[model samples]
Target: MKILVSGGTGLLGQGFLRVLREKGEHEVRCLVRRTSPVERLEGLELAYGDAGDAGSMVRALRGTNAFVHVAGVQYTPEVLEAMRRAGLERLVIVSSTSAHSRFEFRSAPRLVNEALLPGSGLRWTVVRPSMIYGSELDHNMHKLLRFLDRSPVFPLFGSGENLWQPVYYEDLARGLYAALTKPGTDGQIYDLPGPRPLTYLDLVRTAADTLDKKARIVRIPAEPVRRALLVAERIGLPMPVSSEQVLRLREDKAYPYEKARRELGYTPRAFKEGIALEAGRLREIGLVR
Candidate 1:
């Protein structure tokens, strides 16, 4: 089976491609733009196209039987049309745990797309990954690792009590691969999270422990900081984070992956183990000395 993958050079995309190459079962090709860097994905065939455009996706969809779409859920309509036009039957699209968040504006489109997939008359599976992290390129845990490595103090927002279960990149990629290959996964939505959820403070301490850093955990009030970030963004002032991000830190991001486990055999590594690997990778790239 020949599968076309969008965002094949991205973080999760790279991990998924690595899995496909290791298994060596199906023919895999990456649908990338002409200007995309083709350095890391050396052996895979490249289909130059844009996921945002239906016509471009159609062009890239030529001869591909299935798709591992890592593009945003907002483009599902375009992808559906393009896949139908190209006669592609199978689709495995990535969504986020944020879709389930209380933030309606951020989650609406994703919810709509999840609703749109089941009735589309296609074999579709929605895999919602929670806080993907593995290397510095993850832009999540590695940033914290970098910060912990550099600073002696960790200014945590809120009470640092909201729960989160972040899945490793390779684990998430494997889950996607499972959904792509497993027979009963069609029309199903799977949440791929870590082995267990931990408090934000626990997360910080875990990373801090891994780094063996004696960083001071200072708890700053979240409301005032959120308002300040809002004003800063409105005034074109620079802030490390946005207001929405600040607000979301208070949300409990933990979700059970039992369905993924039962159906896809998904078993994520522990957060400590995952973060340790991330720390090692950051060290490799000289991001965290």
Candidate 2:
């Protein structure tokens, strides 16, 4: 079997490529931009293109048996068209668990983007991973680790009671590969979360513990922060944090990956263990001082 992967240079996609290489069962091609750090994807076949451009996607997707999309899901229409043109049927899209986000402005798009697919004559499976973390390349946990490394103060936007479950990056990538290879997965939506959920306060403590640093957690009142961010947005002032983000921090992101586990064999490691591994990796890479 041959597979075409987009977003192959990022941490999750790179992890997927590692699995593909280890299995050595299928031929793979990566759709990438010239600006993409193709260095990370060394020794893989490359198709120079961006998913936003329908023509290029069509070109790159030609002759591929399946597609695994790790890029933005908002590009769904373009990729579907390309798949249709290429006569490809299998698709595994790496959507975020934030598709269930409390903010309408955000969640609506994720829901709407993938809704266009039922009648498209495709076997599409969506994997919504929750707060993916594992390596230094990760966005969420990596930033937290770095911030904790530099500063003793870690701010809590809310009461820090809201739950969060961050899946390891490799776990998500492995499940994504499973989604592509497993049968009976057509038109299924899987939520891939960590082994267990922890409170937001516990999250900071866990990261600080793994990094072997004492953290000073300061809880900033959520209402005031939200109002300030809203005012900033209304006045066209650039703010580091947005009202949506603040509000989202108040929402619990705990989800169960039982479906993925039952179907895709996706058994994720605990956040405690995962974060320690990430910290160790950062130290080895000289990212942690």
Candidate 3:
């Protein structure tokens, strides 16, 4: 099978490529911008294009049997039209569970794109994942790990009771690949989360444990942290925390992944075990120092 992937330079896109390469039978082509890094995808074929542009996507998707879209936002109509023109049938799209949460406003456009897929008379599946983490390339957990490594005292924003179910990047990638090949997946949406949920405090503590460090967690008011981060943003100082992130930190992100588990045979590792794997990888790559 010949497959084309968008968002090929992203964390999840790279992971999906790794899985595809391991299979070794399918020919994979990635849709990337001219300036996008191809180092991680050294041997894979690359199609220089943007998913939002019809002409570009159509050109890139030509002769591809299936397309995996890892982008958060896309021009769904144009993409579907391009796929149709190229005689491509299967499409697996990556969306966020936040689309169904209180933070839907931030991910509204992605939901719109997802909505366009089912009725386009095409084979489509939407995989919604919770906070994704793995490898040094990951933005979420790795950042937390780095912060925990440097700071002796860690701040637990709010009550730190909000539950979070973060899926490892590899598992999410596998889920996408499964969705691509599995039959009767058309018009279905799968929530791919870790095997279990953990509280915000537990998440931090788990990372600390993985790193073999004792974490001194202190409860901090969320409002003050948000204010400080906003001020830092205005002053052009780079900070990981954002207003949206603070809002999300306060909300529970745990969701049911039984659909994915039953349909796709998706079995994700527990957060404790997954974090240890990620830590080992980071250490092996000398990224933890």
Candidate 4:
């Protein structure tokens, strides 16, 4: 199979490419922007193009059997039309669980992009995954790891009890590969999440323990953090925390993985186990001791 992958330079996209290469069953070509970092895609065939550029997109999609899109944003109409012109048969788009959540930071735009898939004259599957972790380039759990490593104390937003299911990038990569080859996934939407859910505090505690750190967790009110972040955004200050980040911490992000497990044979590692592996990677990169 000849597959074209957009966002091939992203963490998840890189993971997917690695998986495909390991399998050695398909010819994988990835779309890389001119300004994209190519370090992660050392041995892969890259087609220089932007998704928004119709000519580039068409050029990239030509002669590809299918495409797996892991780009962290929505697909454009021109790209979809280009897929048709290129005679692409199927598409595997990686959306997020954020699209189903109440927060509007990234979800709203994702839904708008998802709305374009159906009746678009192509076989498409939308995989909505939970928090993606593992790997060196992961911003989600790596940020937490950095904070736990550098600070004597970690901040726990709210009661720090809201449930979260973070899927490892490797597991998500397998799921995407399955979605690409699976037969009945056309026009299907599956939640590709982790095997188990952990509380916010427990998640932090696990990260600390994995790194052999004994940092005290400090609980702070969500409202105050949100207000402070809002104020910082209004002014000329930089704040890592956003209102949506504070709000999401208070809500449960757990989702059922039964559909993906049944259809794609998606099996995710336990949260603690996955983080421990990530800790090892961090040590190799000198991100942690």
Candidate 1: stretches off by over 4 Å: none
| TM-scores of the models, in the order given | 0.97, 0.96, 0.92, 0.94
Error of 3 at 110 (Å): 2.7
| lDDT for each residue of candidate 4 in 81-168, tens digit (9 for 90 to 100) | 8788888868888889887777777578888888898878889998988999988779989888888889998767799889899999
lDDT of 2 by residue, 143-237 (tens): 89989999968887879999999989888778888888888899999998898889988999999999889989887899998998899899999
Q: Which pairs clash inside model 3?
A: none
Cα deviation at 190, candidate 1, in Å, is: 0.4
Among all windows of ten consecutive residues in candidate 3, which has the lowest summed lDDT?
A: 71-80
Better TM-score candidate (1, 3)? 1
Whole-model lDDT per candidate: 0.89, 0.88, 0.84, 0.85
Residue 233, candidate 1: alpha-carbon lDDT: 95
Question: Per-residue alpha-carbon lDDT of model 1 for 177-274, expressed as tens digits?
Answer: 99999999999999998899999999999998898887699889999999989999999998888999988888899898789999999999999999
Candidate 4, residue 193: lDDT: 88
TM-score, structure 3 vs. true: 0.92
Better of 1 and 4 by TM-score: 1
Model 2: how far is 1 from its true place, Å?
Answer: 0.8
